[model samples]
Target: MSNNDIKFIHWFRSASPYIRVHKGKTFVIHMDDSVIGSDNFTGLVHDLALLNSLEIRLVLVFSTRHSIESRLNDHADVSHYHNGIRITDSETMEVIKDAAGKLRVEIEAALSVGLGNTPMLNAKVIISSGNYVRAKPMGVVDGVDYLYTGTVRSIETETINKQLDANEIVLIPPLGYSITGDVFNLQATALTRDVATKLGADKIIYLSSVDGISDQSGKLIKEMIVTEAEKYLLENKIPDAAEQQLLSHAVYACKKGIDRVHVINSSLDGGLIQELFSRDGVGTMISSTSFDELRQATVDDISGILELIVPLEKSGVLVERSREKLELEIENFTVMLRDDVIIGCGALYLYEKEMTAEVACLVIHGDYKNSGRGEQIYSVLEQRARENSIDSIFVLTTQAEHWFRELGFDEISVDELPVEKKELYNFKRNSKIFIKKLN
Candidate 1:
């Protein structure tokens, strides 16, 4: 009925795939005190409620770093850290317990809101929190006694899983207990990693102060595999301490068999939903495998390839290709896939006798055309041509002449076409011929 309505409909439709896949999958989310106290906290809670409604099992692990600092400062007590970990003495431990308890209650209250005419209306989200984590003290290291600072020794997975099975969100505070009736402070990042790994969660997400992981040039990296993330950490490429910590644990979680880890700015409203429900999320994702893949197409990809190109074909921007033809020529195609959907594709037809190749059916999905996906597909095709020892490559285009020209292709006469292609050329199309020579 309106532009906004249309956009909303499109977005909802686009998110349907993610929604389907995320259903019944467990996601472990880690948030620091910064997120709990942020202005968008309520909105984030609402999004999480929506996820629960969609049948996604949620495990929320929260830290109270800022809260503890505020309490310590109020009491005129100084905090200590060794190797970036807070050393919690008797007094600071009391502050941590107070902060964590208060914050957990605040989060629970926020999640329980369901006022009329509000986002949470009719959304009754149940939350569960308990001594689900068991801890062992870090003990003494390097001749320093680190009392009360601990690591996760084991998790009460059966109890947590029972809560999840009942469709309740499991809220884990950054505090663990020992067999001797002692409480210990735990790092939220490490807790998130251990929880997700132990529970075999589908994803581990960090809602943090920073936007996401970025390269040294300050460009946001949308996706990276475990190895690349480790390289970044090893070289100290990530500048933000928060992001560095998250990345370090993200690498660990992925290596430990968690399929995906996402880090997004908690201050950004609706970021949780966007990161979960969109094709290209608003944050960096670390996975054990590539999230988006560009590789040679197989016969199975003919359907996705045709879905991408049929619109162009109908618009007369390219010639029509039947499914039968696509199946036969699928081996000649390279496709760019996002979540296993072909978003961009091109085919290279080599004329080995003439030492040339034809780049054909270059198409990018309408949603991704502006994001340089076309160039990525073209680069792959060019590489393929070189690998095959082609002296030059060409394209016949009724449109996109300017694009080819920008890629260093010069206009050529149809008469210069390879003898075999010249005979098969469509004179009715009157397409321009562009060729790029490799030397």
Candidate 2:
């Protein structure tokens, strides 16, 4: 894989539950201009690169509104409120064109670079607005006609899908035209959500200028299920305006069967990769209640297993074990597999005592790292320990101290080990002792 592909895989492993759930399926990426400045944008690019490398079918959609230059020239007095509401008058409609037009060109330019200069510029970028969106005017809600602003009446899903199938990235400007040929300015957020819902996208990621959804304490809310996000919104737990938008998008995505949605900062370097590839990501992920399982390793699983471990072993992040050793001990191992391939694996060693055992050789395949596969394997091993009447389990690892610490394993001096274990420890290469009590 290329560097961008590796970065993308890392990000996917971190933030997306669909990585495990939606194997061999197509993905549609919806990004807007605001995403251009965030660290998450780089990760988004990384994910796109990865999908390309893996030969996964992907549809990348870039949405934008008009440019500030056009808007200013058209409506000299129009301005936007802090809440993202535009203060518009009759003249505002004239300037809306400039803003939306300039923004679209800028977005296309960015995407061209993001796609690795892959000829996306010359490639067909279906840019049009007409019956593509059926909208009704947001007519005078209280005493205002709400001139030029409209809500979606319907989206032409078939047309969008046809272009998506042709691998043409759809670029939707916030300007939409009615069948009667009247031009109306639309909110980018509203348009994006409508398009995503209409298309039934697999994932909808919102890249924002802020640090993502946060609790009252200002710490980033890393992951949340749909129910938890609703409660947070209802209770006013989210602290900022940016977070509120993210929560709203997340809830909308979940309700619309988008499967998963991510709200992350766009300014941080590798922000997207951290969210997609690592377990403790830098943003919030909202999804449904889908828990994956760990299974027994099979003979056909060796290649993927090797791909995961070889790099780590070469860099000494994992112990160097021969393929023969792995094949022989394959029966002693349990793996977290998705789509008939192993994403994670670990070994269980049975000791003589009825209530004691050792869990060792834990490894998460490189591409699958940080997706909680390691934790799943550990949970399974703990259950197996109970089944075998093992009261406690221990592990020795040179690295991954923090990982084991987070899982409730406390460090113990080597002197506390059983005589045989201590002897084994002495002969073993790199080691740190971790013990977990099972009752």
The best candidate by lDDT is: 1
Task: Encode model 2's per-residue lDDT on 375-431: one tens digit a residue.
Answer: 888888888888888877888888988899898888988887777777767444658
Error of 2 at 142 (Å): 5.9
Over 12-60, each residue of candidate 1 has an lDDT whose tens digit, in order, gives 8667767766889999998867878578888888898899999999999
Q: Please state the error at residue 384 of candidate 1 in Å.
A: 14
Q: List the RMSD of every prediction in angstroms.
A: 5.1, 7.7
Best candidate (score: TM-score)? 1
TM-score of 1: 0.75
Poorest lDDT segment (10 consecutive residues) of candidate 2: 121-130
Identify the runs in model 2 with alpha carbons over 4 angstroms from their true place: 1-70, 73-75, 80-90, 109-131, 140-145, 267-282, 290-304, 308-334, 337-343, 346-439
Q: Show pairs that collide, candidate 1.
A: none
